[model samples]
Target chain A: MARIIQCVPNFSEGRNKEIIEKIVEEVRIMEEVKLLDYSMDKDHNRTVVTFIGEPEKVILAAFNACKVASELIDMKNHTGEHPRMGATDVIPIIPISDVTMDECVQLSKELGERIGKELNIPVFLYEKSAQTSLRENLADVRRGQYEGMAEKLKDEMWKPDFGPANLNERAGVTAVGARMPLVAFNVNLGTDDINVAKNIAKGVRASSGGFKYCKALGIEIKERNIVQVSMNMVDYTKTPLYRVFDVIEREAKRYGVNVVGSEVVGLLPMAALIDVADYYLRLESFDHSQILEKRMFE
Target chain B: MARIIQCVPNFSEGRNKEIIEKIVEEVRIMEEVKLLDYSMDKDHNRTVVTFIGEPEKVILAAFNACKVASELIDMKNHTGEHPRMGATDVIPIIPISDVTMDECVQLSKELGERIGKELNIPVFLYEKSAQTSLRENLADVRRGQYEGMAEKLKDEMWKPDFGPANLNERAGVTAVGARMPLVAFNVNLGTDDINVAKNIAKGVRASSGGFKYCKALGIEIKERNIVQVSMNMVDYTKTPLYRVFDVIEREAKRYGVNVVGSEVVGLLPMAALIDVADYYLRLESFDHSQILEKRMFE
Candidate 1:
């Protein structure tokens, strides 16, 4: 099987279309890499580029793209609604096919070191690639953003995992890490009662006593007259989608509210959906290998 | 989007590894064509080669592989447990991505004409490419196999759809057609009672007035002491997998039997499984576009 990895790097400049285009163009030049998506948010002043390919090809494409972003984006002048600490910001490597999470972590560490040494940008490892537990959550490392990084660097505990403690006025610092595929799944309820949705969200999210890897928020789709329990399944393998849906269904039944429909916000691995089918359909022991198309990959 | 089509051709020369390898070698030479799978059955004396690519590239590879099969295989000395009609017995082109069934029908007709004109072997179009309703079912056209095909060729009703009416004593005749992706889905019963399995099959198959596109049969695995309801989902879009499993579950309940597990025999399109997930999860208006990986194709 071919080892496939995906990289989605968020850069701090979204309003400047020229710079975003220039940075994305670098990824398009790689023959083996497939550019999946690139979107700019003016409010956040961030551009997120998604691409996937063989591990090596993805790494090279990501390296080149980040290099261009670092050179063009000036964090000192950057202002956005979304949190940020660097020009390139956060580059996350996700294992898509035969590649494992451990391998992705290793790749992220190697890339983080190279960026620190070659690009002279301070690098902090977050998520699976973090060297310390304090640095695991990206929000923690980027708490003060670029402006406060200079003062934070004076403390040994706040020093970056890579490069000099001194902050780069232009590029700032970058977060490089590896993580499992995250699925953005949402369920809409039939009732217009936003409280019902909020209660359900409270009962099903990690912050409460719900699924461990699930982060959920209830929002009212006023136009549609429905309450939605939007969710981010950070670890689909451990929690699985069916369990979440079933729990919500059970929870909604308490208030006589029914689930109208569910939605998957973004791309998910085939394995994630197959598990749902297996459970709901009562398929005793279903495996992806049974699918003929997967046979081609084998 | 790129148009993608899959072709699986069964040739009658499995025991001879050299001949099988030579024939498969032709398919491997085509650029942009993916040779997904090729397997030989010694007892059946047959080899099924699966491949996919652009329509033109698939056709080129199919033709080249057929030419090699015809050269090495002789009908006079052939014997197999499975049915056989020619050196290259059957070729079915299936639309995989960004392609329609109507387009596949056109491609099948064009390929049929070329095979007859260039190879001089009798060809009959079955399934979606069948000119007449009676010829649509492959079993009807391939009846009596190779030995009886020569005599059947004399009948006006049995005239070849393409090529000479006369059969090649060695190559016999070939069946070419277009069809939807066939999903071989099997559900295992909890009990060891074979009759219970047989009864469940009758209640869930098209011929038995179950699901329209489902073809089901009951089989016993003597060694495992288990019975299975083997099914072929002819058109998954019309008769989705979740519906079929549910119907079987309902019917099995009558016989005091429960579904142990289900097995997907071969490859299935990712969309098919996603449909099951959406339906079972009560997902409203879900689109594959939401998948981040799908953006790679864009």
Candidate 2:
């Protein structure tokens, strides 16, 4: 099976149609890589581009898109609701198929090195690709934003992983890392009681001593007259969907409520859903290769 | 999205390794098409080759493989436990992705025409590709086998669909058609009593006035000390896996038996398992495109 990696890069500019298209065009032109999605948020003044392919092809596309973003998006005049550090704010490489986290870390370093030497953009390795715990979280890496980055770089502990310790005036700085795919999942309750949803979310969220990779919140779906335990599943490989769903089902039963429905807000890995089937059906010796469509990639 | 079709063609020779390799080589060489699987049952003296690709590419691979089978296999000297009527026994075209049954039927006809005209093999379009009710079933089309094919062809009702009325003495006749992918599923019961399994099987099998596309039988798993309701789900789209599973689960409950587990014998369409998730999870507004890997194909 070929090693597949997904790359999601957030660029600082989203309002200019011409600039957005030009930046996205770099990824669109890579024949081997698929441009799964690219959405521009005018409010945040940011665009998130999603694509996947073989590691080499994906890295090339990510680099090309970052190059385009750095050239056209000048940090001096940039303003947005979302926090920012550079034109291409962040690039995260996620291993999808027949790939390992270690390999993705190496890939992130390679990409960071390329952006540092070729594009002259300061790059900080974050998440799984970070050299220290201080840089592991994206919030800490972008703590100062683009404006304070130059002054923050003067600190001995705030040294960039690659490029000059000083910030690039036009591009600012970029954060490159390796991480798991995030799944936006929500489970609805039969009752409209918001407290039930809140209790369940509190019991299941990481901060409340639930599944470590799950970040959950209690929300209301007014149209449906129901409450929901919405979540961002950061690492499905470690904490599967079935386990979380089962917990929510049992939790809802305590309040004489049923799990009316669930929603996957955006795209999720096929393996995540297959794991649900395997659990519900009590499948024996089931391998991912047993999925017919998976054979095409192999 | 590209229209994808799966083609499984059975050839008369199996014991001869060189001959089997030569026939399968035709499909393996086509880079655009994926050779999913190929297995030889020496007892049946048959080799079933499975492959999938775009309609045109799949049709070309099927035709090329059929040509090799006809040239290498001679039905006059063929002998096996399984019944046969030609060198290339039968070709079933199955719609996989972004394709419909009607499109597959047309593809089968195109493949049949080419085989008949170029390879001098009489082709009988069976199943969905049949022109008359009498030829719709494969067993009916191959009733006389290779030995009686020539004599049977003499009758007005037995005329070839795409070739001369007389059958080829060496290669004999071939059956080509379109059909849905069959899933071999088995549901195991916690109880050892075979009657519990048998009753459930009878309740779900089509022959006993159950699901129209289901063929079921109760069997014993001696190793596991459990009884199972094994099934050949002929059309998953029409009779989904979840429906059959639900029926079996309910039936087993009547006999105070709990469902231990289930097994999918071989490769099944990814959609089949996804449907199970959608049903049990009560997924709302879930589209097949929402699958991340599926986007790679699109």
Go through the candidates in order and give each one's C-alpha lDDT: 0.86, 0.91
lDDT of 2 at A75: 98
- Could you tell me which residue pairs clash in candidate 2? none
Candidate 2 predicts chain B with a TM-score of 0.96
- Span of ten consecutive residues with least summed lDDT in model 2 chain A: A289-298
Cα error, residue A129 of model 1, in Å, equals: 1.1
Query: What docking grade does candidate 1 earn?
Result: medium
lDDT (Cα, tens digit) per residue for candidate 2, span A225-282: 9999999999988888888988999999999999988989888888889988888898
Candidate 2, B1-298: lDDT as tens digits: 2457889999998899999999888889986689988899999999999998778988998898888888888887999988899999999999877788999999999999999999988999999999999999999999989999999999989999998778898899999999998999999999889988888899999999899999999999999899999999999999998899988999898888999999999888888899899888889999988877777767
TM-score leader: 2
Q: How large is the i-RMS for each model, in angstroms?
A: 2.7, 1.5
TM-score of chain A of 1: 0.92
**TM-score on 0 to 1 scale for chain A of candidate 2:** 0.97
Off by over 4 Å in 2: none
Give one digit per residue, the lDDT tens place, for model 1 in B138-224: 889999999999999999999999998999887889999999999889988878888888898898899978899999999997777
RMSD of 2: 1.9
> Looking at candidate 2, what is the lDDT of residue B116?
92
